[model samples]
Target: MLSVHEITELSEEFETKTPQEIIQWAADTFWPEIAMSSSFQTQSMPLLHMVTSLNRSIPVFFIDTGYHFWETLMFREKIASEWKINVIDLYRDHRWDVFAKQNIRSLPLEDPNLCCYLHKVQPMQKALKDIKAWISGIRRDQTSVRAHAKILELQENGLLKINPLLNWKKSDVQEYMEEYNLPAHPLYEKGYKSVGCAPCTVAIGVNDDERAGRWAGRGKVECGLHTDMFSKKDIADVQNEFHLDITKVK
Candidate 1:
């Protein structure tokens, strides 16, 4: 486990390195215990390609929220097959059953935050429970909440989170994808700058924020996975409301 001081020092060290260099460092530092998370979006392609280039067997986790666009799932299959990457599909366990039991199928409509927690955060926390470190494709420029993110963040649970693309710009991602000949998510052509679950995502127009499409009109910016929006009380209330034992969902 890296101490806070060590994380700070390493963040500074990684600041001078390219995304690939930082990824390589992470692979060397924590290979078997390290994994990458992807949403199969344009921004995630570079990191997925980079991690697989280092080690194809490195686990890549994708949360299947049961609400993703059909194209997104197809893209995941395409990437996994083409790259021969070991992609781990993580889903909210028994989500449909839970929804049925609660007589609620569309939680996002009433409470998007709770829906995200049940479908994304809880499942992800379980998937990453054994992992010592994980790589994410987040860039500081994507959202204001993520602007202050470090290249390396030590989570409260002691898991090390590496954001190799922390310093990458939108143009950098574009160039990398072009250079690598990676396929963009099908929805990208439709102007969905930021992709999440289908219900919470929409197409953004030119001159709009890159993430304007996500959780549009909900006054929500993040999906709770990347931010500390959910408090313990919030989680408890959601669980009680849905009659869900999130930790035992699987």
Candidate 2:
């Protein structure tokens, strides 16, 4: 457990290092207790390759939202088998039938915040319960909300969160992938800049931002996994509106 001052000092020190060097520091500092959380997106290949190269046995968590594209799932399997790394599949504990009963087949359209909470955030929270530290491939330029994020952060739950590729840009990610001959996500070539659940993703034009296609035209940018989701009133309203049993979500 690193103190706040220690974390700040380390973040400054890591600012000048390459992504691989930062990952190596994390591997040396918190090997057995550290795990990587990957969405297997286009930007993820570089970090995934880097971490596995350091320690193949480090757990890699993939939140299986049960609504991901067939291609994404297939690609996940391909990477897992090729790398022979420990890939843990995390899923929401709720039954689909309950959501279906509430006519919530397309929650991302009706209530994306709740949808993300149930599908992505909750599952990830459960997966990280026993983990001391976690690594992600989030880069500063990926989203405005994440633009100011540091390379190292202490999450609200006291877990250490490490973003080794925080300073990387899209071009850097591409170069890393190309240099290693890593395969791109099948949908990336189809114009999907940011891939999440199949329903919430779309193809983007060349002039758009990398995440412009996500939740397209819905005025929603993030899925609540990376950003704060709801206020107390917001949660209560959602619970009341959908007759949702918040207690059962976790």
Candidate topping lDDT: 1
Per-residue lDDT tens digits of candidate 2, residues 1-250?
6899999999999999998898888888887888999999887899999999889999999998878999999999999998898999988756544763465576778887778776777678777778778898888998888898889988877778899899989999989988999999999989987898988999999889999998989988887666652222334455676687866432
Q: Encode model 1's per-residue lDDT on 171-223: one tens digit a residue.
A: 89899999989899999989998899998899999789889999889899888
How many residue pairs clash per model? 0, 0
Model 1 spans > 4 angstroms off: 100-105, 229-250
lDDT of 1: 0.84
Per-model TM values vs. the true structure: 0.90, 0.90
Clashing pairs in model 1, backbone N/Cα/C closer than 3 A: none
**lDDT of all predictions:** 0.84, 0.83
